[model samples]
Each structure stands twice: as structure tokens, then as C-alpha cells.
Target: MSRKTVEFVFASAVTTNGTFTVSYPTGYTKGDFSRGVMHRLIALQSTFESPKGITCSFGASSVTVTYKGTTTIPAGSKGIFGFDIAGPDTFRETDWKKQNHIINRPAILRFVNFGSPSTVSTTALISAATGTEMPATAASITYTYATQGGSSPIDGANTDGKLYPARNIVTTVTHASSVPTMTVTHTFLDVNGNQAVETHTTSGGGTSNTITGSKAAAQLISTKIANASTTQTTTGATLNVGFGSKLGFDIPILDSTQIAMEIHDGAMQGVWRGNEILPFALGANEVGTGGVLRRIPAPINGRIVSAYAAVEVANNANNAGTIAISIEQTNSNGSGVTVAGCELAFAASATIGTVVSGSTAEGAATAEVSTGNQICVVATAGFSTNAQFSGSIVMRPTYTVRGTLAVADITTVPSGTSGDIYGTYTPAFTLDGSKQVGLLVWTPEPNSNGTPQYTV
Candidate 1:
């Protein structure tokens, strides 16, 4: 016979101790079914259960196995042939308590080839844990190849490999979609309760700095920056950063929607009288658009019965002078406060704000204040002389203001001038329902400077 004809004849024969052929049905899952077939046939072809009781049947187009019990071969299935026979079995633990323990009963299998079977232990192959036994159109199957001695033949070919045919398994579970939201704020002030200025190193030696006060403190809290003073820098002494002084304060953020702050008012009280007194012009340049000082809108409405303003004056023979500062506000035209449709006049002695009649070394001395009058800060001592004073005052109508400024959300508070100082969260999630609630909070950060650069 010809070699080709001999090869054909050899391939057509089914060996009881060596090989077998697999024939998938025409309507079987259209793609790969190797693993599916293998898993199904493994149990049917098992000899460990009954040894000789297990047997295999070969057909002209496909193969089947018969055992003590009945079995079925779907459109796509697998088969294995070997001289050694083994199958799944059950083991028990000596002690009842250890029966369910993994160490007590473990699955085991043993097989040996009697003859020089080239496909016994040598060509033995098994699929990995078949996650499930579904008739996937395109399933994957894995098998192993070994030498006649049952040892791996390829260098690393024996290593584990995975296969995912054109199919997948299905599973069901539950997941969640919820998150969180927060906000922050900060403030800066001078030892004298005035806005402090800081020099910047980036303004081409310019003396531009952030103004120190509740405004600066509010900025810090809102931005969630660790330290604002450290962020200030300078290059040359051509100019001092007098835009704002170096001042720091803490404003407590109570809740997502509210915050409270206890500000440090500079020195002596009642220095600033009612609108009756004209506030020192400082100069026409300081007056701004209106005759009003630039200020953050008050959070609520109240009166400044009195205040404390403090200052330190350096002795300078060439520039010896004194100046004082004070403030007063009112809802004179019913723009701020009105009770029971009755318009209250600021001219009324009852309409009181704040008065600072005290003085410090650098500036103003005794400045009397009254209702419907301007609060004044008069220099009682010399500016060039060593002078410093501290004082407090009485407030009327309970100083209460409303905060109307809109705040944004925040993620992380910036630190050490390196990380993000502030962030706003959106599409805020809630712990309660499918929808979410939006709000904000200020995260806390430690101080960088132990004390103020200039004391009040």
C-alpha cells in the first residue's frame, strides 16, 4: 500500500488505548466548542468511578461513551483516549467535625500506563477549570502535551496558558454609583486688625501683595490653602509690598452652608465717630469710586458701638507724625434695616454702628464719635515716636450681617505651596437616593507661620 493510503487507514481507525476522533454536529454552536465538549465527556469517560464499568463507543461520523449510567453528547463535545484509566471519586474524613474541612478530604487521581503507550501518561491533557458548561457558539478548550514518560516535552510549553474562544460566560451581581461633596474658606489679617500687604517675587521687583484682613482670610478658607503667608514672596527692596500686610486669622466653618469668624480689630475703640466726622482722605487716591473704603459686603447687619485699634510707630526724626483710623455704617435710607414698615432714621441717636475713641502711638489721638456722625481716628502721639496702643469698644444692635457671596465645591485643600488649594465638586452624589444633593465645606489645614510679621 502507498504511504498516503497507509496514513489514511491509520487515521480512520479508533484506538482503544491511544486516540479517538471528535465530530461536531452541523448545527452545533457555529464557532469553537472544544472546551464544552471536553468538560461534558470527562465525566462520562471516567474510569475512576467503575474502571471496567466505563467504556467508549465509536461511530462512522462521531464517537460516544457508555457507562453504567446514561450519558449525552451535545452537538459540540470532546473525548479522550488513554491506556491508564481514572475518574472522579469521593473521599471522607476520619472525624465528623473535619468532614467539610479542605485538609480532611481532598480530590486525588492516580494513573499508570501498562504498555509502551505513546499516548497514555505521555500525551495526557486536561482543560482548566471550566467555569461553566454552557453550549457557547465559540468556546475555548485547553489541553497539555507530554513525553512518553509523562514529563513535559517543551521547555516552557508546559507552563499554563489561557484561551477565550469567540464566546463568554454570563453572571449577575449588584454595584453602586454614589459619591461625596465639600467646600472650604480662609482669612488673613494684620496684628493691628488692618489689612496686611505681602510682597511678591514675581512682579518684576514690584511691591504688589494680597491685602491682609477678613478678605484674605475668606480667600484662604474658600480656596482651602494650607498657608497664605508662605505663598508671598519678594525679589528686591526697590519697593515694600504694602498692598496688603502679613496678617493671619482663623474663621471656623460650622457647616456646609454656614461659617463663623471672630475678627481681630486693630486697637482703641470709638476712634471713628458717626458720619458727622469726615474720615481722613488718606488722599483722594484712596477714596476709590465712591467716598467709601473698599470692603467685602457685610454678611449681616449690625452696629459697631465701639472698636479697638492698635499700632506700633517707629521713632523717626525726619518723619514724625501721627494718624488714626475708624469706621461706621448704617441703613440710613432703609436700604439695610427697617422695622414694621416704620423707616428708622440713622440720624436718630438709637441708630448706632461703631465708635473708636482710642489711640495708638503711630497715628490719631482722641477722635469723638456720635450718631449720624463719622467715626474718626486721630493721632494723639507721633508716628516717628515709639508708640503703640490697644483698645476695645461696645457694639449696638448686635452686629449681625448676612453672607450673600456664592461659594463653590472643593476636593482637596492645597498644601506646602505644591498641591491643589481648592476644588469644586459637581454632579454631587448623595448617600440616600438615585439623585444627589449639592453643598460645600471647608477642610482644615495647619499654619505655616507661628506669628504675624508685624504686631498691632
Candidate 2:
């Protein structure tokens, strides 16, 4: 809403240290104003005028002026007095926030003479102010919502305040619309909050800088960078990579042996009681050997590197026989086939705590296992009832551990300077692929000489 005021200067000179009055022949009225003003006035006048330093006041029907200036009022001296169109005594505008006006046109104002030319008379005729139009008025009125795309225009079909003082800007605005904000679930923004990413640098500069994120003493969406931060030594240095690089697994192993041991329990699987042998669940003594000793699920895609089984207790000394156990796996065709070079053998005299490696004499097909495959620990033909033994298998990963990724999901909060500041998260799987592939890629920011060091 807007409030347009029309005012001008009083032509005739004003009196010094004297009084005059202005009257509204027609009765005046009052209403609410945008500035929170609710005065019982159809017209307003300045209590003090410049140059003449005159003072004025309003009565129920007239405005009285008292001049106290040391000099005579200039001939074309200007004075401002605002008067709104007459309206009902009580404000009728329901949206009380807007400035209201009765209508627009010229106002008739009669100024009483000022200062007495005759010193003895004490008061006499002086000048009067000019006239102007008080065209209809306005102050802005609407509700807006600043959303994802942009701030929608003033709601409702009313308008953008095009009254007497047409303008697009509003001093006070309140957003009360129930419109929800559109969501931008995923966006390609940079880690530094800049536009498209730049080229990568192979090294770091020599300055120290802290890249802070929305944090509470925890998390990795940020890191400390440097204009000249040392990366320590090449062979052994602590590296602060902002996010994961590419496809890889968080297997609890970091080496070939460790990975092999991860696929199966490294401990012996068998039952024993105080050095006494019992009937084996694996048919260790009953079947004599040459049958399935145990079966386990192949939980990962890897190559079996070693397989071993051992006797937990010696067979009865009365009967003599030989026993051997080897690792085997069910292929996609469901056929139980023996793995190459993976076996553990025992002689009739074999005692407690005897361990033997699987033969490992098979082709590559039997050595590799896919997820969902079943592992079978088969034994060579031999027999005994007290032959108790334990077994285990080990396999190494067939894929490289990327351990990193290229980009992370970024979220930003505006900061006045360089650009918007952002924090990020690395997704648990490949970015857009449905497959649960663990992969991430990372590169130094363009124009950034950031160096990533190894943490030893």
C-alpha cells in the first residue's frame, strides 16, 4: 500500500512571532494509515515551518499557526501540509494493514492572514500556501513465497500496488502463503560451492586453510586444506581426503591372506571332549572318507587359496585306517566338484592336533567360487568310528579395492563471499546404477593445488 501526499509553499510572507489559522469549510474525517497512524485528522500541518520558524496546530475545524522566526517569510516560501479525502469516522478497510484514502482530487484550504504589518496592531494579513492534487493513494498489499525456483509474484490476482505512487518495492512484507517449496533432491554442485568443477592438480600449495562444514566436532564432509600445508613424507604421511574415491568393499581385510581368511572361519570346526574322540558330524570315522565332510555357503566372489582340515582326537588304536579331507564346491550347474590342491590327509596312527593342507591339485574352475555357491569338504576313502576332525577354507578377493570415489552428495548454506559453503556425503553404492557396487571417484579441485598424502 502507498500513501501519496500533496503539499506546496505559502506564497505571501509569514509573520514573525505571530499567529494565523487554516480552516476546512467541510467537516474533516479520519482513517488508518500504513505507518500505524490513527489520528482524528482529515488534514495535517507542520507545527514549525522553516526560515520563518513558524509553528502551527490543528483544531476541530481550523489549523492555527504561531510564527517565532527572527526574519520575514520569503515571498515564494514553501510549506507542506497533507490532507486525505474525507471518509467515515471509523476505518472500514478490513485489511487494516494497508493505508486507506477516501478518493483523490484537490482540497480547499483557507489560510488566515499572518503577522500584523502595524507594530501597534500585534497581528495582520500575510501569505497563503499553494495547492496540489492528492490523487488516490496506496501502500503494498500481498503475500509472497520465496521458493526453490524464485519468489512467486504477489499472490492472488490483486496487483503489485499500482496506485498513485506506482512501485514494485515494498518496505514491509510478510510471507503467509501455505504453498510448499519444490524439492531439488539431487543437484550437481561443487564441493567448494562454485559452478562446474575445474581441472585437477597433482600437488598442494604451501598455505594452510581450514575448510569447515556445518559441524559439531565430528564428520568428514569437510577437511583442512592449504595454500602451503605440508603433506609430510611421500612414503608415510597422513592423508586427509575429503571423500571416498571409487568402487570397493569394506572387507575386514587389507591383504591377500587376510581376505582369504575372511570368507571362512579361520578356526577349526569340530567337536572334542577332553582329548576323547566322538562320532563326527562330518562322518569323519563312519563313512571312512570319500564323502562330504561339511558344506558351507560361498558368500562372496573370490578364489579359494587354501583349504585345511585336522584331527581333533586320534581314532581307536584297535582298528587302523587312513582318512583325508579336501575342499570342493558346487558350480552354477549344481555339480559338486573338487577344488585343485586343497586337501588334508591323516594316517591310521595320526594323533590329536594333526592338520594337513588340501591337495590344491584341481583346475581354475574348481578354485573359483561365486556368490550363492556351496562349498563341500570331501574326504578320501578310509574308515574308523572315533575319527574326529575339524576343517576350514580360505579365499582371496579377485577384485581391486578402489577405496575412493569421484564425487559426493553436496548440500550448501549461503555464505556472502567466495560462494556458498557446502558439506557432502558419499553414497553407499554406485551413484546412479541400481547394482550395489561400492565405487567413488576423487580428484583435486580445479585451480586447487591440493595434495592428497598417504597416512601411514
Structural similarity to truth (TM-score) of each candidate: 0.15, 0.28
Cα RMSD for candidates in order: 37.1, 36.6
Candidate 1 global Cα RMSD: 37.1
What ranges in model 1 sit over 4 Å off? 1-201, 205-412, 415-456
Which lDDT tens digits does candidate 2 get at residues 160-206? 21111100111111112221111101111232222221111123232
Off by over 4 Å in 2: 1-148, 151-189, 192-285, 299-303, 313-335, 358-366, 395-426, 429-456
Poorest stretch of ten by lDDT in candidate 2: 121-130
TM-score of the candidate numbered 2?
Answer: 0.28
Tens-place lDDT per residue, model 1, 1-456, is 000000111233232333334453433321222111111224333521112223334354443433333333332333333211111112444444543312222322211111111111111112111123111122221112222112221112112211111000011111122110111111223222332222112112222222111122211100111112333221111111111211112222212232222111221211222311122222222211222222222222233333343332222344333233343334232222111111111111211132224322321222222344333333322232233333333333222212122121111111211111111111211112222222222222211121122111
Top model by TM-score, which number?
2
Give me the overall lDDT of model 2: 0.32
